[model samples]
Target: MSKHLFSASLLLAISLVVGKSAWGDDNAQSPEPMPPQLEATIKAFEAIGGMHEYRECYGFPSLKFHFFGLKLDSTDADIKKMPVVPFPFAFTSISNSITDLGVAELAKQKNMRALNLVDAQISGQGLAELTHVKDLEVLNLSNSSIQDKGLEALSNFPQLRALRLGNTEVTDDCFVYVSRLKDLEALDLRFTQVQGKKLNELKPCEKLQQLLFSGCPVTDERLQELGKREALEGLDLDYTQVTDNGTKTLENFPNLRNLSLSATKIADQGLEDVGKQKRLQRLYLSGTRVTDEGMSHLGGLDQLEELALSETKVQDAGLAKLSDLKNLNNLKLIRTQVTGTGFDAFSDVPLQTLNLSHAPISDSGMKAIAQIKTLKELTLDHVPLSDEGAKQLASLDNLTLLSLGHSNIGEEGLKSVSQMSKLRVLDLSDTPVSDDSIKELAKLKELRLLYLSGSVITKDSIAQLKKALPNCDIQSDSK
Candidate 1:
């Protein structure tokens, strides 16, 4: 009885397989084993294939990969047919692969340029396969099980320019392997085990341009070592363990243009050190120990274009230091205790953009800011500005953007700003401005964006405003 049952089960299985072959599934054969040609295409991506289908192959001068809605380990047959190409194409990207395609196998592809194997089950062996792609320029292996050994595979690529190893197991040992790429330009090591020791390993890439080591455990000394490279353009040291002592290292990199030290333990003294970098264009010091005293250091940076001091201890007293930045353009002071007195600091400066949203600046503060004849963009969200205060913004003859969202400005107050002929963007969302006040804005032919959502403006009033400014976008509550 047992033998008969076994035989019957075996026959049933054979019948199902034969039936599937004869009839086919959806008129197509199930994915079969990878063919030799397709296997070779995977090995030699550049010469045999193009970018992932979604990616524009040949769009850039470097590399390309066609990645379209593909998940890792979707099917082995799909992986074998992946495309590879150089830049100047369209729609190319990198995506996660579930299973590890051993590094040796990846390296076999002589032409593969763009590889997006992020969050794939890549191990040390899989990473090693990447060493063989001598022509690879862009490799994104983010969120993989990569360690120092995995990084070792990258040492073989002499032409690699952009590499993203964010959220990997890279350490000092990994940097040793990374330093070998003499032509490396951009390196993103965010959220990794690399510290100061890694800087020593990165010294080989003297031409390196951008370095993002955010959330690393490195000391200030390591940053100093990396700063020695004059070609370093942008550096993001956010959430690092570096302190004021570490900030001293940054003085070595005089060519840096963009710097982010947010959440670092650096105090006013460290900011003073950073202020000495005359080439600094964009600086971010949010959530740092910087105070009003540090504001003096930043005031002297003539090249500074944009600066952020949100949530810092700096008050109105410190704002006076910034009045000297003649080239200053953009400033953000969100969530700071800066009062109307801080507006005095911009009395002499020609600010183009200012974000004081959530600051306790009323009509009096707006009057002080209006003195900035060149002011183009201004935000007064949640301020105590009434009709009288809202009218004070009319002094800005060249003002193109005025955001009074959630303010006490009503329909009468908006009429005061109607005289701003150059005003292009007006955001009055959540204000008490009614339809009657909006009618006054229709005369401004230069208006581009008009937001009156949540206001008492009726549909007929919105239509009146839209009819007048046919080219403008009127976003009303009714919409």
Candidate 2:
């Protein structure tokens, strides 16, 4: 689905660095010649209209694809008569192009494996055409109108491993078909008409490791069905009605590493079980009822790397229990009751990214975490800090991103933040900083994104800043 397969992307990024001059190594003796087969593929891609040239990285040969823009008479019938492109991947803005005849023609290319028709007008009849694609593995039909009967066509895809039907019109009746895909490993049913009890149909999907039901209308009883699954590794039940009892169902996942319970009704009763998941590496509990009592249960999660407890009832005492999690590198505590001594918890850890936005952190509270020399990104949005507290951030040499939005931090206080030469993204929106402080940010040559909304900067000032940092994306609330 990406430019290349997941393993291929990784290979290109880190592993494929020794062989070719494409790796861009300075001491290369000769330029590696492209293979004839690969050259033919490139020629085929160029033969198609609106194709972009490939760029190599990390010595990995770039994938070749074609793009055809606004074809004046593009239609489903028009696409049916069109010939298969020279390459396996392509992007075309053909209106109503997922019709049965068009799909039949596209399926003739046995080499094609990944296709994206997101937000297309494909209906039941049109979707049935996908049954012909035996080798297609990744299919994205998000935001389509494909319904129950149409879903039946996908049950037989031999190589279909990843399917996305999020925001579709199908309900439990459609899930009955989804259950038949035993080979399915990743499934996203978010924002759909799918509801309770019928979700138990997923238990039969033995190979399913990643399931996202965010924004689905599911109850505790229905979600508990997941307790029977042992292969699940990533589960997102965010914005569901699942309570502590439903959270217990996740205990069935022995290999569970990534779980999101954000905006649920889970509290201390469930955290005791969550704390026992020794293999957990990432957990999100934002917008839940977790309190200090629940925080005590999580002290044993030494393997945890990323944890989000934002918008909950966790205070200073609760946060103190998480200080020893040396593996924790990312923490989000937005709008929580954590403040004052709560800030003391993170000073001992090597935190690289922290979000304390919408909390009540004062100058002294801000100083507590300044000792966290490893902090690379920090968000103190709406946590009003005085000028002295703002200056404490200057000691953090690794700070690359800083957001002080609505902190009431004035231009004088911003003088200290302006000294963070390594900062690439800065959010000073909704603050009292004016032109004087705004101009100081221009000195940061590496700054790429600057948010100036709700500040006193004018359109002319933004224009000048844009000119100074021609490549930076500087946004202001001029409108």
Winner by TM-score: 2
Q: TM-score, each model?
A: 0.74, 0.81
Q: Rate the local accuracy (lDDT) of all candidates.
A: 0.68, 0.69
Q: Write the per-residue lDDT of candidate 2 for residues 69-156, one digit (tens) a residue.
A: 1121344555554444444333333344455555555565555555556666776666566566666665667787678788787864
What is the clash tally of candidate 1? 33
Tens digits of per-residue lDDT for model 1, 294-336 = 8888877898877888778888889888888888888878767
Tell me how many clashing residue pairs each candidate has: 33, 0
